[model samples]
Target: MKFYDFGDIIASDTEFVIFGIPWDYLSSKDNVNSSTAPQKIREVTKDLALTTEMGVEIPSLKVVDIGDVSIDPTNIERNLREIKDFLIAIYNQKKDVIPVMIGGDHFCTFPVVKTISKEFIADDNIGVLIFDAHLDLYDKWDKGVYSHATVSHRIYDLDQFNKNNLLIVGTRDIDIPEMKIANEKGINHFDAFLFSDLGFKNLSKDIVAFFQNSRIKSLYVSIDIDVLDPSIAPGTGYAIPGGLSYRELWQLLRLLAKNFKIIGCDIVEVSPNLDAPNKMTSNLAAKLLIEFISFISN
Candidate 1:
């Protein structure tokens, strides 16, 4: 099924355009299959309640699920080009629509972000906020430069992004090399453990303040499912402890939407194969996507 049974075409009044990236060949783990996430998440949405937790009717949201990008898993360059062109086509239809992406892996975010950033006449006021368990700051990984593990670094390498405008949060699992690179580049990330020390209110404010201080007005958020505690979201490749709770993230996203113009967003790395029999991870992914849409809509 399509996301919330939304239309398959983008119209003039479309506020959000939802699409999927079904390629995961760039993920570091061989056992985990995140490639199935986009479809699985869509399938679960059919069983969800028609209204959001805040009582907003889901059907009223101006969203269209245009379906997944055609991907050849082994062909990385071709997939990147296809994903970029797919987004370009969406903008060709409507420039003001917010693109919501459901992903195969974190690497899927790279192409979408790259394409969206280019659409801006001046990217100086744009910022990127990433929610993940690992820094994903490696310049290269087992599969080389284009791997999922190198996604953040690749984004940072973009001409319009820098330490001030790009922030990574909910990090707990950090490899020595990635940590060293993050430190050397002066990249700032909020570790998961800080939630306990700072509390949710202060932490959320600080996140907003980071971009505000940098004079960032347009924000793009990327969420890796593993950023949540493993007990609650175990369907991701890396199950790290000391992650954010569902409520925490929900409130944070609410605050973010209130504070900045969220131009585009993506939720990635949800490995349905590793989820419980109840399909909790996919359900959570679906919930987060819809709720965020609701927040942005209101």
Candidate 2:
């Protein structure tokens, strides 16, 4: 579905473009029905109003939903290529349009990150802000290099992405191997405990200051729904306890939107099949995206 479906808001150039990738072959976890997340999120967003509580208006924004990318679960290489080519086309066609992607799984982030890093090749100023429970820094998991568990490792290997420019937030689940890699790469991270201790205001201030000091002018945000406490977002494949609260997630996005020029983003791992009948997980995901886009508009 189109993000807003406003018939009268037509223009040659759009400021935001929403799209989906519905292939979940790379997810090691079962119930790979996360491929259905894009449509589920669109459904829950139907009841949303045109403005956020912060008074950021969304109706006036020029945004379009280009639908899901054509992907084949059996063909992993082809899936990645399709995603990369699709985004490259969009950027080439509309330089100002920041793409917001709905993912099939956390692995969906690899291609998007790679594409954005290459898009802004002028400097190493393009940073990544990932809200995920896992470190996702494994070199390979279950004998596969492109699985969801190794997203950060692949991105870190990219020539355009600097190790120091990577920041993982809301992380609590990480294996010793992932931790070793993070330490070796000097990748910065913040867990749920630190977030609660620092509070939203101080944490946001520190994050923005870190980015500014590092000269990170462009950012790509990747949010794994599992970053939220499973009680709040139980539809994800991997559910971790003691995750960030919904309000905390929203506040972090607001701060990032207000402080940085977010070039592209993805919301991943919303497994509709695992959700309760209320579909609260999808509703929360939609609301977060709405607030984020609204903030970007303002």
Candidate 3:
């Protein structure tokens, strides 16, 4: 394995291990530019504040920067195999280790869903909280299957794991046919309009309800950082104009942590090339991940 070695990360009792996957093949801004994401984000985190202002000491959770899995974007099939094997090693471990996955692009989500579904939920289903602006489910792309635009659809691509246990929030940029496709998959999309019409009080209750109603015990959250407004997170290749605010997302995470059992999750589509002073996107992603991990620990 050509993976980075944070020696004894599993044996030394680490709660979270950061895994980087730097390859977004179908990013619309430029072809194959996402190949540099892992390196770029690490460069930016050099000066990132480890603790918050209110003085919640970030836990001594052993964080090892285990680098990206080996893959060539030109060969999608081979890439998928390697990624799955890597995640299987993470999830199927006898000891407890939560993989905090950072991205190359949205397409990276497919291998994650595939591995977790087969490894953990082969007999029982697993639910996911998809926080994104777009409905990410194109039937096909470039006369080939499996692109960033079609990850959500791939979640159900497997025969055993395709149960209606998914709850999608912050979706405001779906095409007419896209909404129909989501409906056909039996997904309950709580659109951004709910935050406007129902208010966060009702919205939070709805989120709690979604998990409570699902038969699945484990929750895997996949956040496309574009779920936040462009003003706050302009570091994504495909960003929508209006999306969730930072504090609102925090509130949602707090609720998720308290209410559900998050098996594993990730944040994808962080493009450092679009960042402003202080690599705002990378810093924000790290802080957010830290908070979510803290919530899970508490």
Candidate 4:
């Protein structure tokens, strides 16, 4: 029921706190609802193995699933406030614990990143790394600025973030306008196709070197489930053609964990209603979250 059956209470030894934002009103898709993803991902975790692929015992990890943040589907501003407050509460309990968020949609990432960045010391060199199929860089979307389509742009608007410290990878389904915005702003993104040309290890090193060169010592990673190839992760709202395979992403996260202090992270945009009968996408989401947590714990 809970994520990996972790406790609901954060203790002194809690290294990670898991929570969800069950809202998807900002997503552009009309038929697909990702709001249920947080619980669906948790439910599928009931069947997962207790040890990570690398032989780490998951039950020994210091993680607590605090459950979902209260959300009003139609109230964007209020939902944002609540999400922020929820993360603040986690930090208040354990200032150094990593917050792992399961999402309602990519837009849910905006508030989490915003609130987590605020918890850092002013001099801390913090960065954001986003993995997505498309660049959610629209200055505004669907007549407003708070839509999921504009989540990256909203993070870009944050005073602490900039082109140098923000990176988007696993992109392949970008729009012309978003391309123009990224190009003009000098925001760096690695297209999905490059995985073949560069190989996984080299690409992982490049990603690590990117932050090292920027002098970024702390990171907040946001993963849109669509970043994984749709063949393996077809439950997202946007089932794009080309994306990173699970192994490739796992390698990248592993390398990142070794190189930077991942202060907070989120996995978003998984649409259970659109998934295959086996629910592979939600399963993949659960796996990635647990694996990444394991990497961080090590």
TM-scores for every candidate against the unseen true structure: 0.98, 0.94, 0.89, 0.98
Instruction: Say which candidate scores most in lDDT.
Output: 1
Ranking by TM-score: 1, 4, 2, 3
State the lDDT of candidate 2 residue by residue for 14-38, as single tens digits.
7888888987778888766889998
Instruction: Report the lDDT tens digits of candidate 3 across residue range 1-298.
Output: 1112233355446666667777777565573355666666666555555554345555454556567888786778898899888877765653356676778788887787777767665436468788999878777766356777777777757654453677778988897776788778776778887897999779989887776776666778888888898888888876687799988888888788887777778888888777776678777777677778777764
Worst 10 residues of 3 by lDDT: 1-10
Write model 4 residue lDDT over 94-210, tens digit each, in one string.
889999999888999999998888754454699999999988999999949998899999999999988989999999988999999999999999888887889877778888989
Candidate 4 Cα lDDT to native: 0.91
lDDT of 1 by residue, 21-103 (tens): 98789999988888899899999999999999999999999999999999999988899899989998988899888999999
Error of 4 at 203 (Å): 1.8
Candidate 1 to truth, TM: 0.98
Q: Is candidate 1 or 3 superior in lDDT?
A: 1
- Residue 138 of model 2, lDDT score: 88
Return the lDDT, model 4, position 152.
92
User: Candidate 2 — which residues are off by over 4 angstroms?
Assistant: 6-10, 120-123
